[model samples]
Target: MHKPQGYPDVSAYLIVPDAAAVLDFCAAAFNADRLRVIARDGGGILHAECRIGDSVVMMGEMPDGPDAHLHLYLADAEAAFDRAVAAGAEIVQPMQSQDDGDLRGGVRDTSGTTWWIARQEEA
Candidate 1:
């Protein structure tokens, strides 16, 4: 039998040291619209999803290892970078428009979580 047709992409999850804490920070810094959260017995997040603009950001408790971070695509990376910095986020990488057609930069939030912001050039 063949698998039924379905949405190609459903969701993604991020493992962090503090899911609830990070969720709050993301909401404040990026205006994330939290969708749902499932908390585990040990206070770790079992599952969670948030919406920043049209894109969805999924996060949960970090596994037994190092932390993880990811990048986000925006219309104006420079503007986003500035706002994040003004909000007390540390600059991990300075803003620069790359030859590959992207304005990119990095910032580490107050919780020590790093985030990359970029703007892809229009084709």
Candidate 2:
């Protein structure tokens, strides 16, 4: 299915070692609105959905695979970057307003998953 522009047209899962903790951190730091959480016997996240603005980001347990990364376009990437750092996120990329009018940066969560957060400014 194709999602409309400015809405998330794609979804990716971050397979973290600690789904619960990551979920909590995302909620607290980025104001993630958790929509669903499904768990199985081993305390792994079977599935989950979170909304940061118009984007829906999903997550699950890594289940012994390569690390995962997620990208997001926020309303204020610089503010979000600062907040994430204060909330214990590792800085992978410094915040800067792009030439194309996007305030962008990258950070690695405590789970080692990198997220590229950005906010589009009017041209």
Candidate 3:
């Protein structure tokens, strides 16, 4: 199957209770760029997409959307974690260097998604 240009081989799809909150949190926390939004007729979002680095994150608003967890690798995990905290995310795990050669941390956003942010610390 042919994928969209610049899209990763695997993408994360989020089912959120509030698409706007998800988009805002992703923007503030992960530095994700909003790509698309299909607004639902009454008031909420039907579908949306955003880009974080090379990955495309798709989402839809539903009353009973399931929660999600994501492990995202970034060039600067520290800054991302700080932004996430500033954006009202609850700290799930503190940032630290792991024995597996990575600096990692975790946070839970307003959308109920736990993001595991990490960076390579060694080769």
For candidate 2, the C-alpha RMSD (Å) to the true structure equals 3.6
Candidate 1 lDDT for residue 9: 50
> By TM-score, how accurate is candidate 1?
0.74
Q: Candidates 1 and 3: which is better by TM-score?
A: 3
lDDT of 1 by residue, 1-123 (tens): 242232125444566667777677677667778877988886678887787766677776765435567688877667778878877788999988779888788998765678898888666
Q: How many backbone clashes does candidate 2 have?
A: 0
Highest-lDDT candidate:
3
Residue 41 lDDT in model 2?
75
| Alpha-carbon lDDT, every model | 0.73, 0.77, 0.91
Could you give the candidate ranking by TM-score, starting with the highest?
A: 3, 2, 1
Worst 10 residues of 2 by lDDT: 1-10
lDDT of 2 by residue, 37-94 (tens): 8996766778777777767777777645466777777767777888888878898889
Which is better, 1 or 3, measured by lDDT?
3
lDDT of 1 at 10: 46
For model 1 the local lDDT of residue 55 reads: 67
Q: Which residue pairs overlap in candidate 1's backbone? A: none
How many angstroms is residue 106 displaced in model 1 relative to the true structure, after the best TM-score fit?
0.7
Candidate 3 lDDT, 82-118, residue by residue in tens: 9999999999999998998989999998878899999
